[model samples]
Target: MKKVHLGLDVGGTASRWVACDPDGQVVARGSVDGATAHVFNPAERQRLGTALAQMAAALVAEDLVAVGMVGGLTGFGSAAAAEIAALAKEALGLAPAQLLLTDDIVLAFAAQFQPGEGHLISAGTGSIGVHVAADGKMTRVGGRGILIDDAGSGSWIALRALDAIYRVLDRTGSLAEVQRLAGALFALVGGSEWHHVRQYVYGGDRGRIGALAVGVAQAAEAGDATALQILAEAGAELARLAQALQTRAGDRPIALIGGVLNLHGSIGTEIQNRLPGTPISQPNSDTALAAARLQASGEEHAWRAILASMLTPPVPSLGSSVSAAAP
Candidate 1:
């Protein structure tokens, strides 16, 4: 039987798994619904376990044995780390020594840079800046989650767009001026009624809300001024995260990662404008694959080299625009 190392990148919006052989060749890969590491929450814990089981079953069906597993999970604080680790071990059929778990941001940083080499700005469902020093100390800025405002994140952008749309309605009693944005957002929400927006915002999880960022991006692409401004502000907010980390970690190169950066070009451009002369690269490498390589090599330097070799050009947008119909 062929043995493989498993790497899992589990976030609020998506969970991806990659299996790599000893020679660092990808053997299998899969993705499932996203889950967080806040295992103390019963619902989240169940989602995490289910996602792990799904990935494990897929590997088993492919006749691959997992010898080691590394997982990077969102909300992987100390409070629920042990429980989450145990869940992964049981679901993936790995022993305690064969498993390593960490925060998703840490995994993302490792995928892009070796410790002390640079700072990482990740803007997904949430936003955060992370710097891991050579001495093994980690500094983090922002990423407080949606409740406290993960500024410049997908969720933040979605919230800002919704807030703006409603404000326009309140003042003008119509969405005529911001019809493009309003229509885009309402389409995602499934209705333009107040109850629809209220239910979607209050009844669903953060991931569901974060998904609305797509509509905001779409509206911006269609030349909606409000949507464009929101995205630009998001970029500035993300830059603030990088800047905060710079104050403590010094001026290191910045690596931007996450779905939010992929939403539009303006976010990346705004970040560059705010921090001139700072080297920023959005390396295109799979975080799960990087985790697998890291687990296989057990050496950060070796994993970093492997990750660097896989870097591709920055992601490009389709440049397609959607026509918005008023709701």
Candidate 2:
């Protein structure tokens, strides 16, 4: 019988999995509602665990054991890796020795970079920049969360847009621009008044507020100066993040990941212009494959060996959009 391998990538917006048999062919693939370990509410945390359990049960069939498994999840750290492993062991029927858990950034980085020096800036509901050194050292910047950091992320952009809407209302007092631009944005959110936007924002969770960035992006594309400026500033902030990582880790190619950056968007152009001589490449595989390629030994070649067996290229990320996946 062929051994089964499993890879899971969980983010704030969605979770995805890919399973491969010993023959190196994909046997099972699926997605589910987002589950991250960053929640503070007890009920929300329980929901996350339940979501993980459901995903695991759906992927692995009866009378079959998962020989090995790896998971790259949001808010995962040394402190939480063990807990995640325990969860997986119970939920997936895997032994402790057969599982590995790590931060989603690791999977995102590995998806685009190889066993060398490279930098990655990922923006989504949250943002983080990572630098993997030639000596196998890892350095990270940002990704602290919405309240304190994540400068270039969707939440950050949404907050900025909200601030702009307030500023325009306070400064302009029904100017034509406000009625034409900011008012239109408000309407898109189903709010006839600013207080309605406030109610909608406060009524939902962080992901709901973060989803407002989509309206901002749409406004920018429609030639809203304020929206355009907001996106430009976002690009500038992300470039600064890239520059910070490159300065410490030495100049290297940068990979951009996440949903906020459209292929034809100004953010990519801004990053390229700011970081001269540094190449920016897209990930060849999705985060699930990257996590699945992780080896028990945690060596560079071990990962490379797994990657070399891939029969197909990576699919796009599950949470790579402005709106969070509906639960």
Model 1: pairs clashing at backbone N, Cα or C within 3 Å: none
lDDT of each: 0.84, 0.70
Q: Under the 3 Å rule for N, CA and C atoms, how many clashes does model 1 have?
A: 0
**Each candidate: how many clashes?**
0, 1
Per-residue lDDT over 63-83 for candidate 2, one digit per residue giving the tens place of the 0 to 100 score: 345678777777654545556
Residue range 1-327, candidate 1, lDDT tens digits: 689988899977779999999877999999998888878779989999899888878988999999988788886754565687688778876776677777788888888888789999888887888887776667778877788868999999999999999899999999998999999999999999999999999999888999999999999999999999999999999999889888988999999988999999999999999999999899895999999988888764444343232222234568853211100
Candidate 2's TM-score reads 0.84
Best by TM-score: 1
Off by over 4 Å in 1: 300-327
lDDT score, candidate 2, position 15: 86
In lDDT terms, how accurate is model 2? Answer: 0.70
